[model samples]
Every structure is written in C-alpha cells, then in structure tokens.
Target: MTTALTQQLVDLPVIEVLYSDLDNTLLGPEGSLLTGPDGRPSARAAVALVDAAVGGLTVVPVSGRAMPQLRNDARLLGLSDAIGEVGAVILRDGRTQYEWGECPGGIARNPHDTLTATGAVDAVLDAFPGELRPYEPWHRGREGGHLFHGVADVDAANDALAAAGCGWACLRDNGRTGGWEGRSVRAYHLLPRGVGKAPAVADDLAARGLRPEQAAAIGDSVEDLTMAPQVGAFFMVANGHDAPGTIRTPGGMGEGFADAVLALLAHRAGATRDNRQAPAPAEGTVVPSTVLVVEDDEMVADVIRISLTAEGYDVAHVTNTAAALSTIQASPPDLVLLDIMLPEVEGWEVLTQVRSQPHTAHIPVVIMTARTMPADEVRGYNLGASAFMRKPFTPDELLAQVDGVLQDTPRA
Candidate 1:
C-alpha cells in the first residue's frame, strides 16, 4: 500500500513550512553532514530544498539535539531556524532566540520546574545504576528535555521513573537507535509531561501567522510522531518507525528523502499555478476516462484515487488480481493501473490473462511498481503493458503517462 505521506504529497497541499528532524532523517547513515556532488544532502536526494526555501517554504530543523548541535546542522544545511532540546529551545539566525516557556514564545512552558526534572533524572539514573548514563548535553544544562544513553530496556526505565513518582515521561531515541552502524547503547529522553515537538512547532507556526494545515513535518522516530497531529502532513523516513497515516519516503538514512519530498512539492506547486492559467476544457465534454487500479496497498490506491479524481477521471480500485479480473469482466475500464506485487495471483499473470482475452485485450494497461529493473520493464511491455511507472511517482507524472496512453490508443 502507498503510505500516508505519499497520499498527502500527491494531493499537493500548499505546505508553507516544513519541520524536519535531524539525526537519521537528514544525516547520512554514517552521520555525514556533507552535501553530495549535486550539492544536495544525500546521493539519492535532489537539491530541491534550496529551491523550496527560495520559493518561500520555511524549512526548519526540529530535533532533540542540543542548541550547539542544532546550530552546526543549520550551518551545514544553510538553514536559519531550528527547534532544539526536544522542543524546549528555539534558534533563529544561528542564535538561541527562545526557550519554550521561559522565553517570549507562543508555546507555554512546561509547568514542571527544571529542578524537579533534575530530581527525576537522578532517580532514574540511581534506579538503573550503571545501565543508564546521562548524555553529555545534560551535564551542560540543556533545557526542554534531559537525555540519557545506555538504556538497555526502555519499558523498565519508564517503570523506574514511574516508581520514583517522577512526572517526567521517558521517550526512546528512535532516530539514533536504529539502522546501519546504529548506536549500541540505546538513548532515551526524559521530558515534562506536557512538553513535545508538536506544541513547540505549533508555537512557531502561530508566531509566523501560519496554521497547522500550512505546515508539514518529517522525522525518523517515535518522538517525531508527537508533532504529527500539529501539521498538515507528516512524513516518516524509510528507516523510521512505522505509523499509520504518515507519508513514507522511499529513501532512508537521510538519503535524499527530504529532497525528494521538496522536489515533489515544488513540482506540484508549479503544476497547480500553470493549471490555473491554462484554458478550461470544452463545455459538455464526454464522460471522464475511467481507470481500474490494481494494487494491494490501500495508501497507494488512495493516492491514485485522489489524483485521478482531481484530474476529472473516474477511478475503481481493487486489492487483488481476482477482484481486478472480475471488475474487468463486469465492466472494463478505459485503462488499468497494475502493480506487480500482489498478495496472490501476480500482476504479470493478470496482464497475460488480459492480453489473451479478446474482450479485454484492447484495453491499455500501465505498470506501476517498485520493481524497476530493466528486465522487469521489458517483461511488462512484452506482456502488452502500455506504460511503466516506477514507485514514488509524482501526481503530474502519473497523469501525464495516463494522458499519453489514452491519446495513443484508439477508443472502440
């Protein structure tokens, strides 16, 4: 299934602000901060963020890192603003400009005193003994949240915090704890009950006179999920933990996931503006083209449904090959969007079956799947597929291909 991230991006929301988590979401698998030859963040990602910012999208770093680390990242990425310390601190123009509640900011400060939080940190350390060690930033009095490394068991640590009667909540560092060459000692953050990335992000948006629907968030861990409800859309990097209704990027370990998203947004924005100026369709046009989508992923199906519907096409989606065949037999659609990866009854077999049948043989079929090898594309075309689209396609590209195929094929 297509992920929630894909659906939202495909629908082309006007995202004025983008909140990106650092660590695994923007950094390389080896934690490299250097841009690639293309001057983009990673090898696979495009350098569209610069264009996005130039086009007026505010790209802000929202991470759990301390102020110093956040500043370094902002410098490297050419970003000017960030929310650090797990939402306790905010930086603007390379300076620590605001502290959630302590400073003049829209977000209310956590009512719990830092002293009380320090006590909770002490309790957890004492309970876990040698197992839990404070991260270096904590010793420097980083505000917003206290971080610790060497957590062997997150649940047990949370239990210890609860038993100590500490109101602070324990959040596992999902970003730093996973993927290639990941940290061996898992990290956890202890924050006041009401403090999170979401509230801090909300404050930033409000300060800029923007609403939640005008922003989007990208993160690679569970902590990032806290901000999901506060934004128009949330993107989970490929290496991050899975969450329902989040857009999933194909790139992982900061390998251009952010860049890809920015590129899609920029493309969509341009398309929308051009569409606005383009001539309208003739009056009383014939029924819009009907498309049959054969894919198992509901998220992907939804993306196709929304995109095709917006372009004035009727779309019918089926999850399996059996249903696809039944629908075609009952009422053949103008075109078929087939995916090779099906639960059972592979799409190639379906293609072959359709081609051998006289009634359905004339219908055009498009192959849209993650299997993008040359051999796969060749095999699909050999089986009479009309067009081939790789996974992670933009809405504009999908529509263009559909239009091309329809224009080439003679209507019966």
Candidate 2:
C-alpha cells in the first residue's frame, strides 16, 4: 500500500541511485550496513533506508558477487531493487527481474547447475593452473563459479581465460570469495563477455520506467569504473582503492557511503519545491538565492534536496531542462543543477542559454552531474559554471564547493 511517506515522494521528482560494491562501497569491509558494525552495513538498516526511498525513486544495489548469494542477502536485507553478478542478474521487489548474457541454449541442458554461468572463470583457471584457485559453492543445490584466491600472474591468468569458453573476467579486490581452500585474496568481477553493471542497471531502470540519467552509480573499483561513466553520476567512494578523476569521499566504509547518499538526497530535497523564492535580499542576490535542480532521477533528486536544505538554501527541483528553462525565464533561480541528458533540450544547450542571457547569465550555475570525462569537465568549466562536480559526492563537499562560490558574491 502507498504509505504517507511514499505518497509524499510520489509527488516529487525522482532520481535513481545505483550503489555498487557491497563489501565496502555500500556496507563495510565485513558486509555490515549498520553504523557500529565493524565492516559497515548491518543489512537491517540498509533495507530501512532503501525502503524509505522506494516511492520517490528506486535504490538498486549492484554487486559483482554471484546472483544466488546476493539474492539471499537481498531477501535478508529486503532490497526490493537489486542487481548482482556485475549486472548479469537483477532482482526487484524480491523477484527475479531479468538475467542477461546467460544463453538459454547453453544452460538448457544443465537447468539446475549454474556451471554454465562460470564459463569464463573456468577457462581462466584452466589456462593458468597455479595462478587460479577454484572455490566450492557458498550454498547447496547449486554449482557456482570457482573463486580465484591468489594468482601469482594476473596478466597470464587473464590471457589464458580469454582463450577459454568466454565470459566476463574481473580482478578480485575483496578477499571474501574463498578460493584454493582459503589461501589468498584480491578483487575480481569476471563475467560473460557482454555482462556488466551498466547494462544490468540500465535494464532494471527500463523495466521500472526509469532512464540512465535518472540514476546514479556508486563504486570504488575497476568494475564500477566501467559502469560509472554511463550513468547520471559515477560516485567513487574513497575506500583506499584509487582511480583517476574519481571524487574521493572523506571517510571509509559507512561514512563514505552515507556521505554520498546524503549528498544525493540533498539534491532531491532541493528540487522538490514547486515555488522557490530566491534567498532574501539580506541573504544576497538581487533576485533572491533560489535554485532549480533539474534531475529526472528520484533518488538523486532526494539526496540533492537533503544537501541543499541542510545548507539553508531554497530550491525548486524539476525533471526536464525544457520545463526548467521555461520556469527559469518566468522566474529564474540563482543556481541550476543541470544534467547533460534531458528531453527536448540537452543540459549543454541549457547551460549555453543560461550563459548567453543578459539577466540569467550572471546567475551562478553549478554543474552537478556524472559526466566524468576530462572533456566533459573542461566543457562544463568553459561554459562559465561557477563550479562543476561529478555525481555521488557528499553533501558537505557539494555545499562546500557551492558555498565557496557564493561567498564571492557581494551580499545584498
């Protein structure tokens, strides 16, 4: 049934937030989602938070782990929306939503055995005997993929696996997947050739009546790196493992995850209001410091709202840039959170118009987006943005960047 909270969210715009990496990115090192838990997420709290965001926008947890195992956790966590196996499998509302790259013909014979699911893994292990370790299934009645605990030569192992039956291959980053009777550990996400998180989440969104721009993907590993660039925002939680161009979080485990979620929620909150009067003259800006956050994703918009509200900023969040532009001309906000993908007019065109206008040109615009390419960043900055930041950032960080810019304005 639609709860009161859900009803409230239904009225607001939505932004989807896709979190990758259960070990640390979503939970903690130990897979706990609670605050006091050593590893991070305790599972129960994770479900509650997700439940709260359901009607507004979907909260999808994407992981590289096997589907069944993650499914079990999903059941335990009550994650109505989840994607597993680096996006090869998907489950929503506790039901198997979709499975891709698993050829029906190849699996038609086995039916019961998921062995066909581990073709790429088997091939990689066969080519490099000593480098790969195979682990038994984590559950019964299931023939799962073999885990490679420690490999002396990753490059050699990958080359060998390439020649094998063909599937996805990922270097292990977490040591949880026990291989070789629990000898060593590393990060990995090997899967079928066509399988990946972007496709999986994208498919999930399509099924749910959402789009890529309506969602945000968060991760801290190579697998996520492959998917992050495609979403509205690719948040890289700073949990030690580093990637170039990634927005680093201040803390580790739950702190980093919470920080990112909070930032996204702030965006959502900022965009919820229908009529946002700019900040009072005393607050600065002749037209009032109103904001228009243009985001179609509910989860993202909610997070953005939380952040913007916390800063004592008033905002009007909208979905389409075209509608946002019309509103701007009618009543402009002091700032705009423009996403590149939008109906009718793209975010770039919106930015061009914002800069070209005589009245709106001087308004401060912060490009809060997930476009990570250097060219994108350069383009955002070149377009006269006060600040440009990729998605999945912490609210404090986003606020800091915005506050720094607004502080430069002469207070009215």
Candidate 3:
C-alpha cells in the first residue's frame, strides 16, 4: 500500500532478453494490447515490440494465465515463447521447454488439481470469507494454477492452509485485479511449493547459457519483483506502487513496458537516444539486401536497423572499425553505413582500404558522421565514398540513400 521507489542504477549489463509480466503490465486497459493508459487506441506498445525484435533482443511474456491463454497471446503478439501458469509451463518455439508440477503417485497431476484434491484451495477460501473467491470464467481451462481474486491477509490465510493438512499448497499474491467490494483487489494463485516465476526464470536463463547480467524483467506485482535478483535489471510499472531494489518506470501498463524496452535497447545500442518509429515503408516489393551498420552507438544503430529492416533489408551491426573491415572481407554486404568517429581507426581510412581492395572495391560506402567540415567531405570523396550523409538524417533520407546506392550496384 506504500509506494517506495527503488534506488536508481548507475551501470547496467547489456540486456539480451526481457521477461515481462502480462495483464496490466504489457497489455493496457481491458487487456487491449494497443490501447494506451489514457484510454485511447495507440500502437506504441506494438511498435515497441517490433523495436525489440529488430534490435535482436528476446521478449518473453511471463504470466499466471494458463497455456491456452498464453498461446493465443503469443500468436497475437508475434512471439514464439511464453511462460504461463505462473511458471508451471514454459513454451519455446512451440514446444514445452520446461513444465513444472508435483506429479504424485507416478501420475501426472497439475498443481491446481492436487491443491483441490487435498482441500488446500478450500482451506484458503474458507479462511477469508467475502474477501476471497474463485476467479471464475477465465479461471477455467487452467492446468498449472487456480486463480483467486480478493483482498485478504495472505500471510494469515497461508498459515491457516498449512495447519489444515494442506501445507503443500499456499497463496501467492499476484497483484491487482478488477474491483471487489467496489475497490481494486489483488489476484492470488494457489500453486505447488516450488512453482514460481522467479525460479523458473532463473532456471530458464541457465538453460539459455545466459548470466544473470544478460536479462531484465518488468512487471506490476510483488511476485514479479522476486525476479529482481535473477536479472541484470528489474523494473516495476508505476501502477505497481513500489518495492525496494527495483527500477521504476515513468509510465504504467503498456506505456511503461514500451519505455522500459526502449531504455534497454538504448543501453544495448551503446546508449543512443531512445528511438521513435520511422516513416512507414512504401507499399511495394522490397529487394532483400544485407546492409552492414558500422556505428559504435547502440541507439543509432538500432534506429537504422528498424528503418532498413522494415523495408526488408537484412541489417548487420559492428561496434568498431575492425569488425566492419573484417566482415566486409569475409562476406561483403551490399552497402556499408560507416561512422567517422570510431574507437581505433577513422572511417576515412576504412574507406581508403575498401577502395584499394580488389574484391571489396565494388561495395558501396556511405560515410555517416556528425562532423560537417568541407575538408571532411573532400577527404570522403577522395577515398571513394559512394555517399556521404550527415548525422541526424531523417528516416526518409536513410532509406533513399540506401535504396539508390543498392539499385546502382550490379548483382550477378
């Protein structure tokens, strides 16, 4: 009930994956994925998803909902994996990667059924009268955990369930739900002892060969906050109030999710300014071409990727000049977007090397930079730069330059 913000963070790991809680975290009002918190239809959430995908980051939605609900949500969200049933079931690439349960007596039984059979669900329900009730309609067809929604002293009820010969199952406060008693109430889950979002996330990270520093999680519940320890960064939506030791976002629901995603992407893009959507690509056949982006700044590289990838260009990025030259020699892309200020070597020298090489000489180079000296332009042209672009160019300019250069190049 108290809003206590987490202390701010100074340094963060380059996040490779994002674990998000659904239902009021990623999805906005009334479970509408595209709606903003202000109750108007908006595509900010959808665009954020595309930004993460184009930026080459994995997005996994974690929820207490069952497999069926998660399946539908994944289909609509253009995702292939989801963690459902509060971590009891995990589906990746359309197959069950990890499914947790307490199968007793050599029979496969779900936690919800076991809890019901052991009268644990009833014990918790009886302990809290009008304050707790079965979350019906949506609660049916669940295979991992049963849902309950209401306000109750969860600790006292969990103690009562343990004393009633149903210690195997306990109540988990799943954060806020719709109204009960004319005010907001929290959703609860009755799952087996070990099935929880945090453990499953930790185990999933290990299976992916990822360190705790490589992943981040965002959600709007205390249960979701448990993931803070397992991830490189953990963020809470403003609507979730506050918990200590977590980063708080400015927005709530889908808006919060979008903001957090962009922040993470910016960090990965070497801390470029947060990106916004580029102009939609023209409706026409797109020529598939691979464009190598040579920029140390992560955010700008990400924006370029979004713009080009939208037009069906395969984007490859390298943070330094060495990787750029190496990739060009190994497998020359159709075009190279080079930045003048690099870590070790300058972009003009790279262009000179490309021109001198017999095999890579044909590849087009576009010098993109913030420097606007007349001498720099002369140097770029002398080094055989095909096109020189200034920094802070619009998406239209980027698309036109690439399209024009690619069209001029001969293809066998």
Candidate 4:
C-alpha cells in the first residue's frame, strides 16, 4: 500500500539542498544504478537525480563508502559534493576534509591510523570471532573506519572496545548484505565515539551557512536516520528501519528514494507542476545510461558487456572501429569505451573523428590500449580522449575510468 504524503511534510519549507545516501537508497540492490526495486531495468532514481540537478537542487551523497569511491560516484551521478565514510570524510569545495570528532587518541595525524593504533578494530573482530571479518577487497582502502562484514552485536562490540581501554571508539551499523558467509550479514564501521552522520552533517550545515529548514536527507539505514536532527527533516527509504523522527517514503530502494525527491521537488522554486514528471518505466523502457564498447577481442567485449550490464547500464559491443562508428551514427551513446588496436583503421582515427565532429564532439571517449608507451597516453589525451585506461584493467578500474570521464561531461 502506498503511504500518502503527510501534511506535515507538505507544510515544511522548501528544501534547497538534499543529502542522500548511496548504496541502497539512491541506488538499487547491491548498488546497481539502473536496476529498480523489482530487479528490472529502470531509470527512476537516475532521472530524479538529474531532474533535481537541473531544477537547481544541491544534491550531496552521504555514505559509508570511501572518499575516492564516493567522489567517482558523485561525478558519475553528476553531483559535486558528498559526505563519505559515515561523515568521517567530507568532500567540499574541491578539497577533502577529515572531520575526526574528538577522539581520545590525539589527532596528530590520520584519524583512521590513530583509531587503528588503539586496536579497537582487532578487539571488535576478536570479540565476534568467526562472525566478523574486515569487509574484503575494498576495506583496505578505508581511512574513515575499519569496515567489517558480520553479524555484530554493536553494543557488545562497543563494550569490547571500551574494555580494551579504547573508550573513544564505537561501532556503526551500515546495512545488510548477503555477499558473504552464505547468509545475510550487517556492515559495520568502527568509528570514533563522538563522530557520526549527525555531527558530520551538522558541521557541513554550518559550513554551508544554511539553516536546518533549508536541508533534507534521505537514507536507508539506522546510521542514516542519525542525520535527521541535522537537517530540517529526514526521509527514510521504504527499505530502512523506522526511527522516532523518520518518515517512510513510498516504493522501495531507488524508486522510493526518487519518490522522496519528487516530494521535495513539489516545493522547490523551479519545480514542475507535477513533481512525478519522471516516473519509472512502464514495461520496456531504455536504461538511463548507455555505453558502447569497441574492442576487437570477443573475450574483452564480453567481459565489458557483462560488467556494464550487471551495473544496470545498456551496453552495445562492436569488434571493430567500422561497426563502432556505424553504431555511433545510428545511436549516439552516452560514453564510448574505445580500443586503440582496431582493424583497417586505428581507434585513434575514430577518436579524432569523434572529437572533430560537430554532432558528437561532446561525447566523452575512453581509450583502452595495451600500449605502455608514454607517447600513447599523450597522443590519446591530445586527441580529446576523456580518459586513457591501460589495458588489463580490472572491472573496478574500468568503471572508475568511465565514471571519471562522465563526471566531466554533461552527458552524465
């Protein structure tokens, strides 16, 4: 059943700036950008986000993701600012600020290092035993908190930290996932005692010189609800647990987040007469972003297609520059993943033509090549390549490249 809009929410003042969570709120399951809550191709969230951007709303992603990761995401989503690492890292005004909320461990250097030196992470892990482990692969890059994947008794973990003489530390419940241990588990970040989403948000509000009435936040977890007091109000996606001052929006996942966005748009100055102007696709709608992969290798093309498809992007593959150009002329893609080594004509030729053309000059192009020569990168960049990605890149690296280029282009 749909939850009718509350008069209380409708009566609130216009929301000029919106702070939204990333993983399971602005995005769908497992951070799939194009997928809807029903696990189908949908641009509901992306459309709403773009509308908010075009309609003059300052949208900032607030999440527990790493700073660099969030920056890439912010760019891909056509946003400029974000609150990452559960508010531990704040990216504002072209700089990253680490807001280490008063830790007993002196702030002589990196806060994450100071927290690590206290051994609180180890203590939490040891206390939970097999139930806890560092969230693998990406966890090593975190500077905000020691991200862990487990079924953690948060209070018990805090007790362990305090017992270990690290009374200035605590555990934050990020969210739930089934990516490990063959069972659903929660994501936890061991952070400083006083540092959390709320305090971080309050600090950002002060920096922006905006009153609480001008701001609103939306998120899917209990950690997200903490931002309520810092903003004029907080809207929880239908998937999130309820809290005292939270209002649950309709739909689920990305669509639900978009609904909340639509609600705010109703009160904005440049908002449309009907805030639901960009609704979800009915049955066979196109994905929001389309990426064309131009690679000669079938294995490479397949890998690229699969990776992009999994991320909820529409992908078209062409093994040669001839087919690639044909596809481009037939239907212009949002971005091009071009390969340097192509049949008959080199990929550089395609890049040059694409850059010089009037109709397609604005489309961002990413050059992929195994050529390690310095001149190759220089030539690619000179030819207007948005990004020159070295060959043999992991899927993560490829996505990062795509994201970085799109961040600079209006097509994003």
Candidate 5:
C-alpha cells in the first residue's frame, strides 16, 4: 500500500530512536504495518512515533534487508534515514547517508560472487523434495536468501541434508513457529559470518550522534537480544517472555512496541516535569493492606495504597521493580496488585521474578492494567499468574479478587 512520505519535521527537537530487525520486531508477522480489528493498518502508534520524531525524537529503522527492498519499505513508511543490512547501507533523509561495516568496498562490491554461491546453496535446498519450501528468491549482496515457514524435524532434516551432501543450520530457536513453525527458517549465503543486527544498530546510532544510553531498542527474538542490552533501554514484546533481555509489554507487536516507546517518553517527560514541580505523590495515602500495590503510575499507586489501607488491610506501596522486590524481600504480602506497564522494569517481568523466588512464588498476582487483550490474559495465565484484571476496576471488585486469591490454597 502507499504510505505518506514525511515532510520536513522541523517542529520538534531531534532525538534519535533506532530499531533493529524488522520481521517479528518492528514488522509484525503480516509486515511492517499492523492490522486492527477492522483489518486496516493500525497507524496509531506509527503516527504517534512520527509525531514524536517531528516533535524532536529521531526515528531510524535499522534492518538486514538489501538496499532495494529496504528502500521500498522506507518509501512505503516515508522513513528518511534507515540503516539497512545491519549498517551495510545507511539512508539519511532518503539518500545513502553513510556506509560502514562490510559496505563501500566490502559486501556490496561482491554481490555477483555471493549470488553464485547462493545458487549452489539453493541447489541443495532444491534437492530435498517435500522437505523444504522456499518462499521466494530474496537477492541481497552476493548470497541469495529465502524465508521459510513450515513443520520439519530438525534432526531428520539435518540427517537428510547430511545424507544428500548438503549442509544446513537452523538460525531460529524456540521463537520459530506459526508460518515458520517446524518449517520457518532463515538462511544466509552472502557477506561474512559474525555480521549480526546489533553492531549495525550501534554503528548507525554513533553515526547519527546518539549514544546507546540515549536511545531505546525494542525487539522480540534472539536477533533482538544482540542489540537490546546495548541501548539505554531495552524492551521485549509480551509474546517474547522466554526471550532474554526483553521486558514484556501490555500488548503484543505494534501495541507492545508503542507501550515500550511511551514508557520511555513518559519517563523522560516526567523527569523534565519533576524538576519544575514539587515532588509529591499524585494522591498521598497511609492506609494499610495485606495486598501489595505494584503500579508505576504514582496516582494509581497512591489511590490503591490509600484505598486498601482504608479497607483495613496492611498496605505496602512500591513504584518500581527494584523497590517492589526489596519490599517483597523484607515481607511477603498476601497478594500483589500489579500493573502491566512500569518504568525501567515491566509488570510481567516483576511477576515472573516474584514467582521464581521460593519465598514469594506462591503469592497470587492479580494483573491490573489497561492491557485488556485476550492473548495477553492467556499469556498471564500461562506465566503462572492467578488472575488478570484491567485498570479502572472498582475498589470493591479489586477487593473481591484479592480476597478470593488470598482465601484460595496456594498452588504447588
């Protein structure tokens, strides 16, 4: 589809936001565009990001695509400068901005040699009938690449290839499923080994005059882990609970990415506002409750804290994961009222951490957040949470859920 190219965004300050990887990260399973219930591209977050960039945040998408396809996607998104092929090609405002790491005199110079080798590789893939399905020829650099998604026995496939004089490796781990389930695979035959997504993002950020600490990276795969830790902040999509260095979001894919971005922006915005405003809780309370209030929003945290205290339960309030963990260590509460969105650390990570610890693992955690998706609730249950509740819930309903969980026998 046609996407509007952004005109000069001169209104906001230029803050750089760098993203690594496209598929399963920035681009959902469908593509870069996310579909809403009505089946149209959900541009709310994308528009928000664009507005944020125009307002002073610089947004850059760094991926492993070849120049041609990368350029196509950029045109579609109206992205000006993007780092492609993991920094092999850098496009600034729709032009080749800079070239570093296997570019200039490197990979791009040997596309022909790479293509020949890729043809040989394809021969091996073609040898196995009904075993591997090649989606299409993805030509970039010297090696031809193909994306596949299907069910196959790793051991059997390896053995078959070995028997057929062809060698193959599975780059995807447990995260490979769905269209690519047993069949989903990513194979590269060009450039050089050890050329991953992180270094590309890092180099591009440096070129853009941004520090890793000044930027945020959000992803949901082994590929993303390569760059997540290096950035100032790293976030994992909620579906990537098993993936390392990723903090779960209230929503999945586009929504999760949006949540992560907002969390950082909100934190930054709050820091600026804090200097001018007197430091105080949104609503101060001294009530007590056996229920622990674990919300990042100060107002919500205070309201719950005061309301629970007034209800005659010993109340403990903590605003962040570090403090909340410390509080739980000192004294385990009867229940945990958790918000899915939190600063620095996410609510799901906190819940996972709480459940992992023997001292507090059995305590029922009731998720309280604006994330009210069915998949999100199912994921919470799968993660061992007792019950999930959305935000703006009545104190009475909150109390009832808390009572029910506290009264029930702890799961072994």
Candidate 6:
C-alpha cells in the first residue's frame, strides 16, 4: 500500500536540494552499489539523478564513510559535495573545506574542543574488545573522529563509552544487514558532542542560500534521522530503521526509492515553469476548489497534485480504492480525480462506490489514466465519470479539465 509519507512527498511542489546516506540506503541489499543488467549502477536511478541535477537539484551525499571512500564513490557517481565521517568532514567541489574542529566560511562553530577524544575511543575499545574494530578509512584519510564496526549491542557500546566518561555520542547504523548469525551487524560512529549530520547539512544549505524546507534527506538508519529536521522531506528505505512520518520506498537500497524521488523532483521543476504561465482563477473568486486525487503511482500522483495545486485548487490524494472510498465517506471533495488502474480494488469499483453513496453521488468525478481506448472512455462515462482524461497530459490540460468539471457541477 502507498504510505501517507509517500503521498506527502507526492504533494511537495518543489525540492531544491537532496541529501542522501550511502551504504544500504543507496546501494543494493548486498551492501554494494546497485547495478542494472549492464553491470553498472542502475540506469533508472542514474539517469533520474542526472536529470534532477540538470533541472537544478543539488545532490549531496551525507555518509559515515571517510574522506577517501566518499571521494572515490562520489567521483564514480558524479556527485560533487559530500559530508563524510558522519559530518566530521565536509567536502565541497571535491575539496575538504571544513573539518570537525575548524569552522570555514564562518558557517559552523566548533561545538567540541577536540575532534577526537582519545580517551573515549580507548574506553570503548577496551570495553568491547574484539567486538569493536577501528574503521580503517579515518586512518587512511588522516581525519579526526573515529568510526567503529561490529557493534551488535549498541546499548552496551554506549554504556562502555559512558562508563569510561568519554565525551562522545554513539550514532547507530540500523540499516546495515550484514552480521554473524541471524542478527545484523550494527555499526556506530563516535562523534564529538556537537558535531553531527544535521548540523553539517544545515551548514551546507546555509552556504548555498537555501532553507531546510528546500531540501530532502534520504537514509536508512537512526544516524540519518539527525538530518530529518534539516530537509523538506525524509525518506527511509524499506529495510531501514523507522522514523516517525518518514516516507519509505518499496525497493531497498537505491532501486525504486531513488528513482521515485528523482522523478518527483523533475516533475516539480517542469511544473514550476508551467505554473508561471498558468492563468489564475477568475478575479474575486479566490477560495480554491477542493480536489481529491485517486492514483496509485506516487510519481504521477505528485505530478497531478503539483499541477492542480498550482492552479489554485486544494488537493488531497489517495493511492487505492479503499482509501478513496474512506476519504469520500469522511469528507467528500468538490471534485474527484480518479485513476482507472488501482490496487486491491480497481478505480471502476471506486467510482461505483462513490456514485452508490448518497452524499457523494453529485460530486463530479474525472477519470484520468493511461488507458486510452474509446471503450475505456465509454466505460468510464457510463459509470458516472464526469470527464475522461488520458495520461501524458500537460498541466494546462489538467487545469482546464478540472475547471470545466467544477463549472459544470452545480452547488448543493
């Protein structure tokens, strides 16, 4: 079923920036880069990302990986900015401009006196013994902050650090699926008290003159949750740790998840331009009409929401027939934008249910779908759909149809 967070994402009108976590969030289930049939990164995600960048969404990789690892991966993926070592190091334009202890461009203040508290690291190591091992990338890059792996018991690890009076915060990687036995191998990054992904992301956004609402963050673990408040939307992969109100993709890693987000961003960019030229509602008739959109595809649903909302309509969307019926029963909208193809129950059944109800019978329903046969139109119209609109429609066409439907429907 399409989640509420997914619907919310679809309704977003603009996404100026994208902040993402690496590892399981962007890679496949095997903890490697997701490849297509061609043995390279999935084309759908790659192309969509490229398209998003071309359309003006700045993509930044926010990861626990160290500088060298992040740099190599970013180069391979064509990404330019990255927050590495769980925000200890900030790389912009392929250069390290800020480290944990030092502030650059006066964007961030050093919250901690030292980048790495050796006593804290030693304490955790001494406590966990063989269970905790040094994350090698920090040593290779010679950067501050220490990352550790093989932390199956996050509580114990944190307790160990606390017992040692270490001045560090433990960020857990709940998204990592690899581990001995049936349990997953958990990883933790020991960051100084004031340095974290959220602050680092905020600093970067501020540098670009962007607000938190202008960006979206995607990740798979609790560590990534630190970035939730810093972006317009937060998405968690299906297999990752849960955060309240986070949109989850059906596909794990970067598969269907990244593609869906990129598609929405591209659509938003196009709709923004089209909306500028769109005609406004008639003067003095300012209160917008309420629209209920019933569609299954998150990407298409968002596109429709963006388009109709731009034309000054209050839009509500649902992904299946059950939700459509429930929404109609709870609060019947002025107009219903229905899609013929739906999950569980088809759109045809939803239309029948709406018409069968007393309160919603008079509400105008516009059937919008990719089904472009004459019989399909006849079928929809026969089932009480007020208008039939095929897919691949422009924003102008959608607004025009909605206006026509609302105008033809008489007020009760």
Which one wins on lDDT?
A: 3
RMSD of each: 10.0, 16.4, 13.3, 15.2, 16.3, 9.6
Order of candidate numbers by lDDT, starting with the best:
3, 4, 6, 1, 2, 5
lDDT of 6: 0.69
User: What lDDT is reached at residue 11 by model 3?
Assistant: 57
How far in Å is the alpha carbon of 145 misplaced in model 2?
5.3
- Candidate 1 vs 3: which has more TM-score: 3
Model 2 lDDT tens row, 1-412: 1111223333334456545567677677667667523543343335335533542444567876666777777666656667766566677766664443543345533322343454655666666667555444432222222344555455665666556644344333334444455465554444434556777766776777866666666677776777755666666666646876455655456555654555445445445433355343335533336778887755456666665764567878888877877888898776777777676777887788888988888777778765678888888889887788765565556666666666665432
Q: What C-alpha lDDT, on a 0 to 100 scale, does residue 372 get in candidate 4?
A: 94
Question: What are the clash counts of all predictions, listed in order?
Answer: 6, 60, 3, 0, 24, 0
Candidate 2, which segments miss by more than 4 Å at Cα? 1-14, 35-55, 97-99, 102-125, 129-131, 137-146, 152-190, 274-412
Compute the lDDT of residue 110 as modeled in candidate 4.
Answer: 62
TM-score for model 3?
Answer: 0.62
TM-scores of all candidate predictions against the true structure: 0.55, 0.54, 0.62, 0.60, 0.48, 0.57
Which segments of model 1 are wrong by more than 4 Å?
Answer: 1-61, 67-82, 89-133, 136-199, 206-209, 216-288
Candidate 6 worst ten-residue window by lDDT = 103-112
Q: Give the Cα lDDT of each candidate.
A: 0.69, 0.59, 0.78, 0.76, 0.56, 0.69
For candidate 4, lDDT tens digit of each residue in 274-350? 23243343354334478999988554565466446555678888888788888887888999999998988899988
Better of 1 and 4 by TM-score: 4
Candidate 5 matches the true fold with a TM-score of 0.48
Model 4 score (lDDT): 0.76
Best by TM-score: 3
List model 3 lDDT by residue over 168-238, tens digit each. Answer: 66688877778456878898887877778898898889888899988999999878888889998898988
Better lDDT candidate (1, 5): 1
Ordered by TM-score, highest first, the candidates read 3, 4, 6, 1, 2, 5
Quote the lDDT for 211 in model 2: 64
